[model samples]
Target: MTINDIKNLLNATVVSGHQLLDTEVHNACGSDMMSDVLAFVKDQSVLLTGLVNSQVVRTAEMMDMVCIIFVRGKEPSEEIINLAADRGIVLMKTSLRMFPACGILYQAGLRG
Candidate 1:
């Protein structure tokens, strides 16, 4: 699904890279641990996490992820947003917790 679709699905607020909402994402990885994200994730385009830090953006960049969704209403700082914007990665946040957010996307056909 498109990033726009995921946003709608999760009722997320776009924090950065709004212009790239049309970007398509085939799979998703949900975790707050950047180490697990780096070690276990593969071929995933979207990341759902509660961790609000620049390292999250860096992990997404290294994993070639196109989008990061901050779950549980966590918000990234302006610096983190700027970093993601610079890297051309979409950033969004939702009030939903990680499990429900991941479930919604998975039920909508986005795989892990």
Candidate 2:
């Protein structure tokens, strides 16, 4: 699936990287713990997280995720947004909770 489809599925608001909305995403993992995310690095995928820190972007970069969906309406700081922007990772915010966000994406065909 593409970032655009994910946005529609989750009713997410793109916080950055609008130009990357069409990027392809094949897998997804949801976690708020950066260490746990680091433990499970695979191919290009999407990350669903409620963490609102720059470390989330850093971890996503290390894991090579194409996009990050911040659930629970959590917003990252300016530094975090800049970090994600520099890494070319699309960042979005959603009102849905973490479990529901992950479920919606998985149900829409994003998996790991």
* lDDT by residue for model 1 (1-112), tens: 8999999999999999999999988999999899999999999999999999999999999999999999999989999999999999999999999999999999999999
Q: Give the TM-score of candidate 2.
A: 0.95
Against the reference, the lDDT scores of all candidates come to: 0.96, 0.89
TM-score per candidate, in order?
0.99, 0.95
Runs of candidate 2 with Cα error greater than 4 angstroms are none
Choose the strongest candidate by TM-score. 1
Tens-digit lDDT track for model 2 on 1-112? 8999999999999999999999888999888898988886677489898989888998888888889999999988899889989999999999999998888888888887
Regions of candidate 1 where Cα sits further than 4 Å from its true position:
none
Overlapping backbone residue pairs in candidate 1 total 0
